[model samples]
Target: MKLSQSQSFVRFWAASTTSYFGTYITSLSLQVLIVANLQGGAADVGWMNASRWLPYVVLGLVAGVMIDRAQRKYVLVLTDLGRGILMALIGLTDLFGTLQMGWLMVMMMGFGILSIFHDAAYQSFVPQLVPKDMLTRANARLEQSAAVAESSGPALAGGLVAWVGAPFTVLVNAAAYGMSGAWMASIQHASKVEAPAGSVRTQVKEGLRWVYRHPYLRSLALNTHAWFFFHSMTGAVLVTFALVELGFNESKVGFALAAAGIGAVAGSFLSTMVGQRLGVGLAMTFSRILYVPALFLIAVAPSVDSFHSPVFPMFVVMSGQFLYGFAMGVEGPLEMGYRQTVTPLSLQGRMNATMRSINRSMIVIGAPLGGLIADTFGFRTSLTLAVAGLAFCAIWFWLSPMRHAKLDENQIEGV
Candidate 1:
């Protein structure tokens, strides 16, 4: 059946798309708020990034186990509501002139905690909405809409921030999350999984063993962990570099980021074709390699002072971000589809959480380190390290069993 024919998936898609827009808006605006409004720098960005993911490190395994035992739909709605409230509170604190770095970090941690449940449930819930064979297409459709949102969200956010200040801009995400929750509440069709019969600690250990023991998953998880760590470091410093070093304002930065969205849209459109032609593993490997050049452009980008027109540097950086986003858009659906298709329904939540907990734990570690490195060594230096790290991931994928990995009916049947 076509995805459009599935009402449940339609609602899920709508909810996800709405949240994506809000997420992008808040992501950019919050960075601006920290740097421009709060007078925070790289270290502060690192702290904020780290705080948000810290819960994933601490509570991730438990949340995954709980999600496996509970209703994923309810989990999604509740977390969305919780996140909405937190976003609103953040906006209110800034409005009241009481928002400090400490307060912001605390709020981010709350967001992260909810995210632990929300994200794990979100990934695990998707297979219930569509056929295993259709997972790639389903994910592609979701990414297409998300790419569109990414393309436009930042530009819209830039205008919102300029008009209403960054704090008020975040209120937009709160409203979006509320709507997402309501839409999710409307999804009535979901396949239920039997709760695993074990203690939470035992279940968590089982989840860990499942991921670490699977050959393809082990490599994928390790490679992804490394990639996220380095990518996050770049993220921690990029906005600061743009605003401070490149001399770009929120508007210009938004436009540059929008290029990523545009590239993502294109990538999403092409993902299925590419995946079919190259096969899943090769497609993923190709996308992984693209990050090397994409980040290299950013690392070597000439500062504004080096160019007579600030537009020149912005153009180069935008080109890089475009490629960066394209690579992500292409690989995301394939990776998620492969993971979901291979794993048993019973282990979905645990598998996702196990990989994500460690993956994001890297963010908790890398974000701060990136910030510190950027602060001490410089943005370019930190970015150079990130580029090298991404290059390493590409090489690993090329040489590892992942390059030959493919989906098989046998594998999907709990092999």
Candidate 2:
């Protein structure tokens, strides 16, 4: 069946795309609000980002178990509504002059909690919406929409922050989430996965065991954990460095980051061809290698003193972001498709949750660690660490079973 002909897919696509736009906007604007408006610093940014992922560390396993047993469609709708309400509350607080950093942190925690469930359900839900043979294509199309949103949302957010302030811009994100919830609610399909007859611990254990025991998945998980850990460190310090050290205004920073979106869009368009030509494992490995140079580029980005043109430093930073984003875009669809294909439908939610929890756990650690390093040693030092870590992860993947693995051969029997 043509993806265009599927009404359910269209509705799901719309909801996901809308949410992605709002998410990117919030990701950029919220940090700006903290640093620019609230007089927060690197530590504050780190803590806030840590708050956003803490829920995954705490509730991810439980959420995964619940998602596997429940109706995923309702899970998606409820989580979207929950996020909308939470973000709206943030906007209201800002409007009423009570938007403290403490309150913002709390709200981010709420968002994280909802995100744990929403992400687990959403990743697991996609396979039910499309045929098995079309999984890669469906994931590519979905990623394409997200890439387009990423390309534009940051630029728009930068403009909004310049014009209306960061707090007011959050209301737009709130409204987008609300609209996305409504779109999700409009889906007519019932996604009822049978609940496994086991205690939560038993279910969780089974999921973890499956992931660790499978050579391909174990390699993927290890590589993902390392990549996220280092990447989170880079992200934690990036905005602060741009704003404080480099003297970049909100709009300039947004536009610089937006360059990644352009590369991501190209990557999404080219993902299938890359996967076909290089094989999924090789494609993913190549992408990981790109992260070394891309991050090093950002780490060594020249300050204003090093360049005559004021825009030269900004150009250097954006070039790094573009390369990094392109690598991620090319890898995203292939990895996700391979993961879903290898796992059984019944365990999909748990698998995604387990992997994500492990990934996010690193964020919980990396965020604060990055902040501490930046505060103690400085941004350049912390970024240098990130560059080294990325190189190590690439080497790790190359040496693991993943280097020679292919998507077609990764599937286990009876999955």
Candidate 3:
């Protein structure tokens, strides 16, 4: 539990958390800023958002394999530096009155590439730093910190946008990424990734083959990917629904989101205690059930009322977000621990990337579809579909061995 034991990881984690905080700020601020400033439509918004993650969909698996071969610390540092420079240049353009939609989109795409290496390398590095028994707790701590950062990031960005301006938020983000890069460069442990013994394609295939062939991994990926796809679809439309349809102010959504973050923080702490008591598989399955009810609760919320009768949708969104965030917190550490425990240290980067690639692909597919549905059937109907997708995903786990799951102690032993 004590970070002092891993001085390098502590430094790295602290800086990374701050970097995460900045990333969200840029994300929320840019969407609101561009939409407000550009006189743009839904497509513009969609493209702006897509540009940030599209690179990952294209580069994830390849990046993972590359990270497995490269020095992880260098990858992390280089990516952070790239983002920092990009942000600084962005800030300069705003000052020069040369900022445009095209410029912003290109910036997004470039930074997206940098983030690929950053994320792929970091996930791979964690297992190398911690003991097998500590992986869950380590991931939990990191996830908890991230949840806390995300909870505050949007509001901070929104507030800055409201007060001083939107463009300046990029400056803040640039500074954070710079600091993060410096911290990453200070890591003492060299990565333990093994050089591939064969052709690049063959080695990459080996990584993918191992992950998909494992029964637990296959079941876990299906359910997890489904959960994320639907969640992203709903998330893509939530702000539009809450603010546009329900007439709640922007600040109100921020408050509800912040409250849910508090719940996420609780869940991160609870995960270790719960998982240890219930056994990992049983605990993961139980957490999966929580999500179904939560999604249902969210889909059915009524708009805020005249009687101020608790503003059903507002409270519902808040409660559902809390549960969803909590479940995600619980699920993440469980999955990461299980995956890392079973995967060889050398292939960690590739395995992590392969899983991340599938997850990102789901989002890439879901976002535009959600945008279309919201544009056509309406946000409420789109939300209903999203909830249905999530409910249907539950079946993925049920028919498989995952439902009555058991994470045997034997799985942790290395060959």
In terms of lDDT, the best-performing candidate is 1
Give me the runs in candidate 2 sitting further than 4 Å from their true place: 305-308, 409-415
- Model 3 over residues 3-29: C-alpha lDDT tens digits? 568987798788779898888677666
Candidate scoring better on TM-score of 1 and 3 = 1
lDDT of 1 by residue, 1-415 (tens): 7899999999999999999999999989999999988999998999999999999989999988998998999999999999999999999998899999999999999999999999999999999999999999999999998899989998889888888889889999999999999999999875668999989999999999888888788889989999999989998998888888787878888887888899899998899898888888899999999999998998888878888677889889989989998998999888999999888889999999999999999999999999999999998999999999999999999998788777766544544
Taking the tens digit of each residue's C-alpha lDDT, what string does model 2 give over 1-415? 8998889999999999999999989988888988987899888899999999999998998888999998999999999999999999988888788899998999999999999999999999999998777888889998888888888889999999999998888999999999999999999897656788899999999899878888889999988998999999988999888888777889988888888888889888999899989888999999999989988887888776557555888888889988988998899998899889888889999999999998999999998899889989999999999999999999999898877666664344523
Write the number of the candidate with greater lDDT, choosing between 2 and 3.
Answer: 2
The lDDT values for all models are: 0.91, 0.89, 0.76
Model 1 lDDT, residue 355, Cα: 93
Q: List the residue pairs that clash in candidate 2.
A: none
Runs in model 3 deviating more than 4 A are 41-43, 89-98, 304-313, 404-407, 412-415
Measured against the true structure, the TM-scores of the candidates, in listed sequence, are 0.98, 0.97, 0.91
- Decoy 1 TM-score against native: 0.98
Each candidate structure's count of clashing pairs: 0, 0, 0
Clash pairs, model 3 backbone:
none
